[model samples]
Target: MMFGSRGKARFLAAVEGLESAVRDRDAKRCTRGLREIHRAYGKAGDQEIAEGGARLAALLPELPDGPRGGLAVFVGACVERGADARRCAPAVLAGLAQALEAAEEFCERWAASGGGDFPEPDDGDPGPGVVERGGHCAAFGWWTLPQWEMAAAAMLSHVEVRKELDSIVRARLLRDLRTVTEASGHDFKCLEQVLLVLDDEPLVALDRSSGAGYALRMTGLGDTFQLHTLLADVLIGGGHLPGQAPSAREAAVCRDAPGQVPTTGSFNLVAPDGSLLWNEGTPADIPVVDGVRLLVLDPPPYRRGWPAGRFFPNMPGDLVLERVLGAEETAQWFTQVAPAKG
Candidate 1:
């Protein structure tokens, strides 16, 4: 949509206000300025948003580490508030690259200082953790990590950001992410998400019925046993499948049995036309949909001695499985299909 003269005026004013707010380090003013930009972009198209993001990216390096992170998050929030992530990805990735570089420098400096607090930069504004007690005075401290994390999470969650990365940058980012994840005790969600993107993993759909299921990013799975374990975990965790407490022998029996074994019954991975795709095999052996395997776990037989009740609650009695492919497609599926049913 073409911006009218008034809308153009509003957008430019909002951008000017945001620049002023960032320069002054005024958090409230920054937020208000962003909200104004958001309002100005109410009917803007992707091109307009992308242009706005480019304008915002120009101001990123002027801010401190904390507010740099905040601005990155605000961009993500704008995406969530109906700004297109793909359109905003260039700016987001640019900011992420900067944050990662800063974090790397901080890590090197901290290590060089023998794990003690390092001298703050001469920017007058105290860096990260410079006050409050308990070893909180450093050039970069605990305060910076969460900000970096939030920024990373916001950028890495969208697939388009990965497309914006060149090979060298992607490798550097993966390395830096590993460093940060290690420092943060290996519990980083952004790291996990990025790995999925890097490995070109598919989105796994737990198909319940026609037009209903839960979709999760596919993680590494070695074999059918691991796949079965994952399915059981997800199903039992979500209260869709009953928790099983089979006897030692029974447990062994189930475990020892070949692919896709239920606690007391049987299941199959079947195609939409009822042909068996995988009655027994590893995930790698499953059929591919758009370059990634899509497995639809057929509902377990409902029989006596087996766990009773609807295998997939709220699903139609006649189950018809469907599959979606790619990060973008699966994400779209989640937003459009799964939210209402799931």
Candidate 2:
């Protein structure tokens, strides 16, 4: 997508303004003039974006994915209300808010300078463009990659972060694994690496409790799966979303393990729609509608947050609640927890 340098500048300026609004927690004001937040997921083809894609690629540890961006009618407004560009480490994603604000400013300034708006290019796919309802717009484009989907990239990042944490306390974990292997006559791996053992399992059932958080019932769990469902019901007992999942009589809980310990409440459940459960505390699950894969493992015990006392009895750090799936089903979920799919 070729736009005059002036146009690019304007869009970036607008993004900056948007970021400011987000940091200030002013979403409404930031997106006030924007007619729609045209959230776009690119398909492919473009060099400038390919370079941006390269930076995003760094974000992936093992599998790479597509580029994503959103268009706001008042792009500037949205940035201010929804982003925290300053928080990103590499400075690109982090500067998203600023970039958007700058783009908007550049456009407004250029238009004021009598630089007549460029002729509306033909209906060229132009990759990605932010169209304003009144025939105004700030076009932006990006390409989708083949390495992995955007949702997959988020999954990989979760894995990489988990590994970084485990490396810090590797020695202690190694000793524990050795003890488990020798005493149980099982080829035990380090608690920080159970993902390798159950990569293809399906998630059958889920359970959660304020006391134990989320847990799943695996296919092999057999009757055990039902048993977990029973226990989890008792654990999170009275907590549940008002009118979703399970039903008024049954709150099925996420039944998935934790990718990471929650930040608030004792439990936060991530239902299939990403709605969330009570023990599935805090509910930050990605929108399941997009097919984002999730890895639910027991969070590291030493991790911080909550009261940090007997949150879940016998909750092993490396346990993985395998999802037991058949040829055409999501895996069967079980109570075992594993290391983050690191």
Candidate 3:
């Protein structure tokens, strides 16, 4: 529903009040402002909600720690409450993305300077530092960065946000997250969760022969063995395969021989142009197309694995497959034996 002029005015006023309350750290005022905003959202239309989102995004970089975090959560809640997040949340995502980049740079510089004087971050704070025994420590930003990262992750978890995000933006966010994780030497729970959400997002699986398409979600199956195992299930479920499942021994052949009998691994994934989808990185690194990734399942000798060495005839098997189907699957394959005749 579209908002009348008065409703729009009320939303603007509520946003302004919330920003002021956050800056003042006035809990009572903050609550009142939040209530007013919620009331406005209930009465306002999608365009007004999006406009309000833009206003909140403008204020995000200037908010203090508690208020910033709280506001991020509130935005996610608004999406959950059916606020047309596809329209309203992209600006919020962009704001968080920019803030995270700025925070990362600020922390890197602060750490390098060894507690020396540094300019305030884009957030307008004095940088994350605290006094201790009459000395300042620059290490505090490392701790503070996680809060912001998690807040961004929480917002991104929404389905609308994930669908609305541009592929380039999503990839950059993942790269930035990895950089921050490597630099900080800290494993963030949010990082893992977000990786699963983004990397394992459903892809369009196309059947070349029949031209049928399916939205396949390979959750927790980015690794080789798990991925193929799930792929086999998908094939069987989709009626692309017949009879009972094959043994692990035969299934292992899918990694190399694409079309040999007695193994469902003969199927290969290719691009829309029928080119091999080679990967030097994990599945998350796969290129996305048209806001979604596509995988064309073709008759085997699956060549999606790592490229072979040029000079050395037998340098090693495909590194991508070796990495995907690690020792764990090898061990499992060795343990299984043909069924004993009764």
Quote the lDDT for 79 in model 3. Answer: 48
Query: Where does candidate 2 stray beyond 4 Å?
Result: 1-7, 32-152, 155-162, 165-342
Clashes of each: 0, 79, 4
Query: Quick one: ranking by lDDT, best first?
Result: 3, 1, 2
Which residue window of length 10 is worst by lDDT in model 1? 311-320
- Candidate 2, residue 253: Cα displacement in angstroms equals 36
TM for candidate 2 is 0.19
Clashes by residue pair, model 1:
none
For candidate 3, report its TM-score: 0.44
Estimate, for each residue in 119-156, the C-alpha lDDT of model 1 and write its tens digit: 43342334434432213323343335445555554555
Model 2 lDDT, full chain set: 0.28
Report every candidate's CA lDDT. Answer: 0.49, 0.28, 0.50
After superposition, candidate 3 runs with Cα above 4 Å error:
1-16, 19-66, 113-144, 154-160, 189-232, 242-282, 285-342
| Count of clashing pairs, candidate 3 | 4
Cα error, candidate 1, residue 310 (Å): 23
* Residues 38-142 of candidate 3: C-alpha lDDT, one tens digit per residue: 787666656656666656655665554445545665565554444555554555566556555754564576466573433322433333343231122232333
Clashing residue pairs in candidate 3 are 258-266, 258-300, 258-301, 266-300
Task: Determine which window of 10 residues in candidate 3 has minimal summed lDDT.
Answer: 308-317
